[model samples]
Structure formats: C-alpha cells, structure tokens
Target chain A: MDLIKVGMADLAVCKAPQKLITTGLGSCVGVCLYDLEKKVGGLAHIMLPDSTQAKSVQNVAKYADTGIVATIEKLMALGVDRSRILAKIAGGAQMFNFAGTSNIMRIGERNVEAVKKQLEQLKIKLVAEDTGGNFGRTIIFDPQNGQLHIRTINQGEKTI
Target chain B: MEFENLNNLQKDALKEIGNIGAGNAATSLSTLLNKRINMAVPNIFILPFSQVVELMGGAEKPVAGGYLQVSGIAPMSMLFVLPEDSLKLFLNILIGKPMSEKIQLDEMDISVLKEITNILAGSYLTALNGFTNIEFNPSVPALAFDMAGAILGNVLQLYGEVSDYALVIESIFMEEEKEVKGHFFLLPEPGTLEIMLQKLGVVF
Candidate 1:
C-alpha cells in the first residue's frame, strides 16, 4: 500500500490502496476525510483554529477553518462525491497541564470547536473522532478500509 | 522581517545571540548542578514549519520539554528540551538520587524542571537584553514529557498565526564527556528579530 505523509500545516489526498498519515499532533489537529464510495481520502494537519486570526494566510492547511475546507475541496477535486464524504478527526490535545493560563493552552479546545463548526458549515458528517486530551497523538488513515489508526506515547494504538 | 530575506550579517547577529544566551544558560545550569557543563556555539536555522519535527529528532521521539512565552517589546517563544537519558541524568542531579529512565516524574519533579527553565530562560533574556537593550520577560515555564514533535510543534504554535517560517536559535549543552544532552531553542516571534537587529544597528 502506498503511504502519504502529511506534515504540520500541510494536507494530502489519495485514492484506494493508498494510506494517509500524520504524526505528533499536540495542540495541532489532524483532519481525516474518507469517501465511502470512491475509497478516496484526504488528511490535513492544522495548527490553528481560524485563518482570520492570522495576519496573512500563507498556507490554507494551517488553520481548522480553512484547512478543513481545503481538504474537502482537494478530495472532491479527486472525483470523490461530497455527499459520500465522512470525517474522522484525531489530535487537538492540550499536551500540557497549564489550564486556562494562556491563549495557547486553550488552543486545543478551540481548534476542536473550529473544526467541528467548519464541518457543520460545509454539511459534512463527523463519523468518528478521538480528540481533546492532555496527550499527543499520531494518526494514520487507511483509504481502503476508511479505518483511522491513532497512536500515543503512553496510550496504546486504537482504530476508530 | 522576511525570514528568507535575511543577509549574512543579520544571520551572524542571530548566531551571536545564541552564543551569548546559551553561554549564560550553561553557567546557571553548571551552578545548579555543581558541575561544569559545556555548550557549543549555537546554530541558527530558518526552516519551514513542516521540517521542524525533523529538527527535534523526528515526530515520535520522547522528550522532556520546557515551554515559555517571552513577553516584552519583542514577544517570542522559548524552549528547553532534553532527551530521555539526558533528562534522567538531569533529574538525578537535582534529586541527588538515581533516576530510572522508565520512571515517570512526580509533582515535585515537575516543579524542579519548571524552575530550571525559569533560570535558563532568565539568563538567556538577560544576555539578549545586554546586547540590544530589549527587556524581554519570560513567563512561567510549562513542562511536557511527551513526543518531541508534540512539544516542539506546540511551542511553534504559540505564534502560529503569522509564522510561515521559524527563526530558531538552537544550542546544545553537555556535561563532561557528553554525559548529558539538552537543547535550548529561542524562537523569536514574527518580526521580533528585525526589531532586535535594528536596535543593534545591523541593517539587512
């Protein structure tokens, strides 16, 4: 099976027999979208919640608002049906114990909210998610089976 | 300040900052441990966000990270990171007892780690202040013992809004014959480097 790796503030899309993976998501989130009929998948590793907060949008895959939309568009451009698209997100962990102390501390929660909000705005169904914790996660999405594999340092691997 | 547009002289200025800052930090650490710690002159790297995890020894590598927000006229993010064996050595020095590499840190250990960051961060900023007269104040250091990519990525995310490129000043600290290894990363916020450079009369 072919493997496509998505880096921070980056996105990738692939068809059947290809897999998408992103590693080490702390406050950042990894958005995985799979097409049920086409067996196509797209993954975006987003760093921030919204693009409006940035002075300039250098990379669309860096924010939840723009990154989700960009991922969906890329997936659709690959001939996947928008109606058949389902989302599974992982990461967006606090990664630290300092609660409510700074803006970056709360960014994990904000990114989760923004991603869900963006998915709703675009009318995409969020089928599964493993998010919001105090640990880091590495996720892999298989396009053939639409199974998202999540891994952590202390926590064992699980497929959602 | 465009990160890609920095000239050689501007880059040298950045390297000097790393040299002086790390020099001060190593002294504080040496005093704390009651042993001599040697640090090489730091490296100045201007890299894209995607390549940062690789800079930290890949995404899944375990690391003990100290994250701090440097707030002043020029806001920035600062980090002190140590690998597993290195962290074990560091904790062993602090508690005056052998620390197992597999053992998890307790609340008391976390406090010691956080306080160490405070000392290091203070020394770095003080050194920078002496150079550019920029009064950079560091916030309470936050500790994370997790994947290197996670801690490093989150530190980069502190000013993720406008940072397409990270200006990282990286320094390595070692205790006699490289017994311990640690890294200090001083990531100036977007445009902060330009201000510091201007203050130092270095035009790019």
Candidate 2:
C-alpha cells in the first residue's frame, strides 16, 4: 500500500489502495476530499483559516479556504466529478488548554469553521468529521474505503 | 527588516540574545534546586515549517511543553519542551520519587511541572528585557503534555502569515555531567527580529 505524506500547509491527491496521512495536527485542520465511486482522495493540511484575510501568502495550502479549493481543483483534474466528491475533515485541536483573550486561543475553532464553509461553497457534502478538543491528532485517509483513521496520544485511535 | 536580510553581525546579535536568555533560565533552575546547571549555547535557525517539525523530533513525539506569549519591545511566543525521558528525570530530581513507566501526574506533580516552566520562562524573558532595555511582559504560562509538532505548529500559526521560514532559538539544558535535557524555543513575531536588532543598535 502506497502512503503519501502530507506536510503542514501542504496537500496531496491519491487513488484507491493509497493513503494520505498528516501528523501532529494541533490547531491546524486536515481537510480531505474523496470520490468514493472513483476511489480518488486528496488531503490538505491547512494551518490558518482564510488566505484573503492574510497580509501576504505564497502557500495557498496554508489556509483552509484556499487549501480546500486547491485540493478540489486537483481532484477534478484527476477525472473525479465535483458532484461526486465527499468531504471528511479532522484536527483543529487547541493542543493547550488556555483562556486568553487573543485570537490565537480560538484559531482551532476558526479553522474548522472555515474548512466547513469552504466545502459548502464547493457544494461538497461533509460526511464525517473529528475536530476541536485539547489534544493532538494524526489522521490517515484511505481512498479505498473513504474512511479517515484518526490517532491521538491520549484518546487512542478511531475511524470516522 | 525580514529574517533573510539579516547580516552575520545582526544574526549574531539575536544568538547572543538567546544565549543570555538561556543562561538566565539555567541560573534560575540552579537557584531553585540549590545546584549548578548550565545550558549549551543556543542556536538561531530560520527554518521552514517542515524543518521545524523535524527539529522537534517528528510530529508525534511525546513532550512536555510550555507556551507563553511575550508582549513588549520584542514581541514573541516562547515554547519550552522536555521529552518524556527528560520529564521523568525532572520528576525524579525535583520530587525524589521512584516512578513507574505510566506516569499519571496528580495535582502536586502538575504544580511542580508548572513551576519548573514558570522559572525557566520567567527568567529567560527577564534577561531579554534587560538586554533590550525595554519591557517584555509575559502572559500567564500554559503547559501541555502532548506531541511536539502539535504544540509548535499551533504556536507558529499565531506568529502571522508571511514568511515560509520561522525563526527559532533552541537551547539544551545540561545538568550534572554531560547529560543534556529539555529544549527552550523562542518564536519571535514577524517584525520582531527587526525590532530586536534595532534595539541592539543594528539597523538595516
């Protein structure tokens, strides 16, 4: 089985029998788009919420909105229909439990919201999600079964 | 003003700043334990996100981390990480307990860990304030026992959106003998390098 690794602020597209994995996702959200019929999947590990809100950005994969769109475009180029694409997301954890008045404390929630909004904009149905909380997650998306396997240090592992 | 434009001398100034911070932290720990502890001279690296994760010993490595936001002349977010073995060593030395592998820290243990982080970060920031001759107020310290990459990635996101590279000052704490333990990281904000340099009489 081929496993394609997705780094932070990066994305990857793969087919059936291949897995897309991203590790140590704290506040950063991992957005996955899969075409079950075609057995094609793509994962985008996004750090921030919106690219348009940033002053300057060279990596579109660093933002949820842009990263999801970029992943969608790549999946489309792989002969997967946009209408057939389903979304599964994970990560966006606080990593540290702190109550600060700064925007940093809420970035995890914001990233999750931004990712869902992006999927909605692209007219893709979000099938499963594991997000929020105060822990780290490593997620693997298998295109063959269209299941996201999430592993955590304290919470153990589960398929969503 | 950016990190890339920094000359050798300017970069050295930042390393010197990191050296002072680490030294102060070591001294603080020494005072608390009533024994001498020294830290290796810190390294200043301006690396990309992937490199940062790799430097922390991969994304899923379990670690004890401290996160504090320093607000003032040289605004930055600081993270102090100690791996599992080091944390065990700290528990043994600080509390003198014969521990098992499954360490479920009670309230007392949590307090001790929090105090250790406070001493390390408080002294480090104080040295920075003295070096720059400006105020550096640190917010309330927060501690997490989690994966290194998770803690670092979350903090890096707060530093703003611009550069592909993140500046990190890494220090290794050395106790008796040559045993090296714990890591202290200072992630300065986007313009923080320029601010710190200008304060140190190095202007581009």
TM-score of chain A of each: 0.96, 0.97
TM-score of each: 0.96, 0.96
What's the lDDT for all of these models? 0.87, 0.85
* CA lDDT, candidate 1, residue B186: 88
lDDT of 2 at B203: 70
Model 1 C-alpha lDDT per residue in residues A27-108, reported as the tens digit of each score:
8889998896888999999899999988889799999998988888898899988889999998888877663467788888
- Which portions of model 2 miss their true places by more than 4 Å? B177-180
When summed lDDT is taken over every stretch of 10 residues in candidate 2 chain A, the lowest stretch is: A93-102
Question: Where does the lowest 10-residue lDDT sum fall in candidate 1 chain B?
Answer: B96-105
Per-residue lDDT of candidate 2, residues A1-160 (tens digit): 7899998889999998989999899999999899999999999999999899887878989998788889989999999988999999998888776666578888999999999888888789999999999899999999998999999888889999
Best by DockQ: 1
Candidate 1 lDDT over residue span B31-139, tens digit each: 9988899998899888998787676788888888988888888998888988888888888887865766485878888899999999999998999899889888777
Candidate 1 chain A minimal-lDDT segment of 10 residues: A95-104
Top model number, lDDT: 1
Return the clash pairs for model 1, or none: none
**lDDT by residue (tens digit), candidate 2, B172-195:** 887876443778899888878887
Q: What is the lDDT for A112 in model 2?
A: 97
